[model samples]
Target: MRKFLASIAVSLLITGCTFPGVHKIDIPQGNVVTQEMVDQLKPGMTRNQVRYIMGTPLVTDTFSPDRWDYIYSQQKGGEERTQKNLSLFFSDNSLQRISGDYRPGGAAQ
Candidate 1:
């Protein structure tokens, strides 16, 4: 009887390990950029103005001080990650153009 109980307990533990009982919560990272925010951008806008509208960028490269990258990504539990990327190019410390997964206003949508 003791042998039978020990075997049963071991089997339960093994089964539990194989089962997907663990919950993986959604994970989100990086700055969130929106179309409306991009629309607020205008040509020749200063860096401060662009930052005010688009918030701080996710990456600022020292090699390319004229460029700023805004990236956002999310993983829903066990699913694949979805990502969005936007880049702001500056000329003479002023915003020149914007490009990425989204377009300003209804340009793409």
Candidate 2:
């Protein structure tokens, strides 16, 4: 009985000392827009022109037909996640304004 208990305790101790490794999968979501693509955008560009330049937007609202949102986010393992957002507003089916994390010509407005 003593030997059996000792064996059990040793097994338990060994198992307790072992830890399962954690593997974090990279998570990426939304459209991936680059500075060059953003640089191509300009006021008065048509909706199709913007789409051709920046690809499809990540978020589009039915209620807000005049506004389009481009969002990008990614996370890798234990590293800090990064996100970018670009919003375009249209008036009469033409690009009127741009806003969000990225700005054109270093200007926010």
Best by lDDT: 1
Q: Estimate, for each residue in 1-109, the C-alpha lDDT of model 1 and write its tens digit.
A: 9999999999999887456777778999999887788878888999999999889898999999999999999999878999999999999999888888877775556
Candidate 1 Cα misplacement greater than 4 A, ranges = 1-23
Worst 10 contiguous positions by lDDT, candidate 2 = 16-25
- Which clashing pairs does model 2 show? none
Candidate 1 backbone collisions, by pair: none
RMSD of each: 3.2, 5.5
Q: TM-score of each candidate? A: 0.77, 0.73
TM-score of 1: 0.77
Residue 71 displacement in candidate 2 (angstroms): 1.0
lDDT, each prediction: 0.89, 0.87
lDDT of 2 by residue, 1-109 (tens): 9999999999988876354665767998899887778888899999999999998888899999899999899998756999989999999999999999887765433
